[model samples]
Target: MINLFRSYNPLNILWLAVLVIALRIGYIIGAPDKLEFVFVESFARLLVPVSYEYALTPFLNVLLAGALVFAQALLLNKLVNQFNLLGKPSFLPALMYVTISALFTPFLILSAPLICNFLVIWMLYKLFSLYKGDDIKSSGYDLGMIVAIGSLIYLPFIYMFLAVWIALIIFRPFNWREWIAVILGYATIFFFLAVLYYLNDRFHTFYKIWLPLGTQFPNHISINNYTYVLLAPVVFILVLSVFKLQQGFFKSYVHIRKAFQLLLIMFIIAGLSFYVKRQFQLNHFLLCVVPVAITFAYYFLYTTSKWFYESLYLLLLAGIIYFQFNTF
Candidate 1:
């Protein structure tokens, strides 16, 4: 299965869909009678209202989630390929994305982070374009607005506001104007939102939108023991990816080096920002999956030993399935 996605082939898309369904099969079978779909304080609902009621059967819910995630995986794959982030065209990024997205059962369903991922990809596109363009102000403004929109979907997404500054540091020289542009762009969104509230005589509630940003760092989180087993493979892959990156660190092109640095910042920010949510949920970690998938792709693409890499990939798939059935 790993070898099949090592190259770019149109037919591989079919296999990708198959792999998505195969990974979700266990969860589909064991899903609860009434699967809840919650969109906590999502401003996106104003645009597209999601039905919170579990009117559909568990199987159908899982199926629908699987389909949505599968499509996201494909789009994510296309984004990576479009930017040539993997150094060469291949299906590895998509495969890794789908696999990592399923590592946690909570990630299998439609969630805010999953929706915010589309914005993340859009942000990356604008960030990467910085290397080739001289228009820092416009790009910074666009990225700020993108992050602002994402925050409306998932409040923790506001943390991605840091990535814009980090990307500017990685891709451009010091310029205070560009930095200010980001702030201006972010405020632009809320300025309009505040106006809407004022017109509706609900301006008093406008301040409540920032409440999630004030959540304290968590002291404790109860997680199943099985989740630790699930983390083992991911940790191993990340360790291997770090070592691999170190080996070729200085030798890679300047743009590639900066891109990896930007991705690292994204991963760290996304992971830590989960604390911003008052209630800790596993699905919140979906924000980390995008960069982690790219990191996994780096390891899988560069590792020389076919037998070892393939075995590791299988181990990851097995871990996800086993834990899904064993735990939930």
Candidate 2:
């Protein structure tokens, strides 16, 4: 399977579809009767002024989510190849993304963080272009708005605003205007939201959106031990990818190095920002899959041991399918 995706072939998409179904089939068969889809965050509910939670049959829920994951994987793969991030094109990123997105049951269904991934990919495309463009103030502003939009879907997504500044620092010189443009961009969305609040006579509740920012980090998070077991392969691959990157970090082109650095920061911010949501769940980490899949692609592309990498990827697939059928 790894060998099949190691090259960029259009036919591989058929295999990717099969992979998506196979990974999700077990859960779909045993899924709960009622699946709740949270289309937006609570504050966003007020802003959109519609039903945020909708109940759907298990099969329909998984099917829609599967379609979304497939589309996002292709989009991310396009972005990776566009920038020559992996030195050459391959379907590995898409394959890895489909695999990673199914790592947890919650991720296999429709949720706010899963929906926000499209914005994450859009941000990456604009973020990577910063290196080539002469003036990126527009890009900064767009990114700020993008992050704000994503925050509307998932509140923790607000932290991605930091990545806009980090990208400016890595890809461009110190320009205060570019730095400040992001803030104005972020506020642009909220300004309208504030207006809506005032018109609705709910201006008093507008301040509650930022209250989560002040919440203290929990001393400990109670997670099932099996969740760690499920993450074992993910941890192994990330550690290997880090060492593999470190080995050739300076050897890569300047733009590529900075791009990877920015991605690493984005991953950290996305992963840690979940603490801000009082009712966070594993699905929130779907925001990290784009960067993590790219990192996995890097290691798989460069690693010389064909048999070892092949077996490692197989182990990951087997684990995902196995866990889906039998719960810990």
Candidate 3:
């Protein structure tokens, strides 16, 4: 399976779909009867007028989420290839994405972070374009709007707005206008949302939206110790990937280095942004999967030790399936 995805063959997509189902099957079979599809944040929910009674059945919900994951995997794969983020074109990013997205059952369901991933991909496209050194004030504004839209779906996604500036810093010379353009673009969305709040006589409630931003990071989160065992393979793979990148870090192109820097910054921002939400949900980390998947693909793409990388991938797959069934 690892070798199959290591090639860029179009036929590999069929196998990728099969892998998606295999990874998700255990959770789907054991899924509870009620599976809520939550695509909007609490503040946005109030304005959007969602009906609780309109929820999809668990099977269909999982099916739709699986389809979304597949679609996202393909999009992410395209993005990595388009930018040549990986040395050569291959489906490894897509494969790694599906695998990591299924690492937690929470990631298998419909959630705000899952929905926001599309915006994240979109932002990456614009971010990468900054490498051309073209005037990108418009791009900055667009990225800000993307972040705003994502924040409407998942509040933690607002942190991605920092990525807009971070990309500019890494990819372009100092341009204060471009820097401020992103802010204007971000405010552009909320400006209208504020007007809607005032018209509906709920303007007072609008201030409450930023309240969560002030919440202190938690001292600890309640998670099963066994979950760490499940994550061991993932952590191991990421560490290996980081070390591999470090070995060749300076030899890589300047743009590749800057791109990786921006990606690392985005990963940290996405991972820590969960603190803004009063309740910590594992699904929130789905935002980090994009960068992590690309990183994994990098390692798998470059590593010469075929036997080791392939076995590690299989081990990761087995861990996912076993834990999905074990439900620990």
Assess each prediction's global lDDT (C-alpha) against the native. 0.84, 0.91, 0.89
Candidate 3 TM-score, true structure as reference: 0.97
Per-residue error for 213 in candidate 2, Å, reads 0.9
Per-prediction backbone clash count: 0, 0, 0
Per-candidate TM-scores read 0.94, 0.98, 0.97
C-alpha RMSD values across all candidates: 2.0, 1.1, 1.2
Write candidate 2's Cα lDDT for 142-249 as tens digits: 999999998888889999988888898899989999989899999999998889888889899999999999999988887777688889999999999999989989
TM-score of 2: 0.98
Q: How would you encode candidate 3's per-residue C-alpha lDDT over 238-287 as one tens digit per residue? A: 99999999998898888889889998999999999999987779899999
Report the CA-based lDDT of candidate 3 relative to the real structure. Answer: 0.89
Best by lDDT: 2
Model 3, runs deviating above 4 Å: 52-54
lDDT of 1 by residue, 1-328 (tens): 7778988998999999999999998888787777766554553344345566566778877787778778877887887888777788889888998899899888887677877887888888889889878868988888889988888778888989998998888899989999999999999987887887787677787888887777888888989888888899889989999999888888888988899899999999999998877678899888888888888888898899999999999998999988778884
Would you list the rank order by TM-score, best first? 2, 3, 1
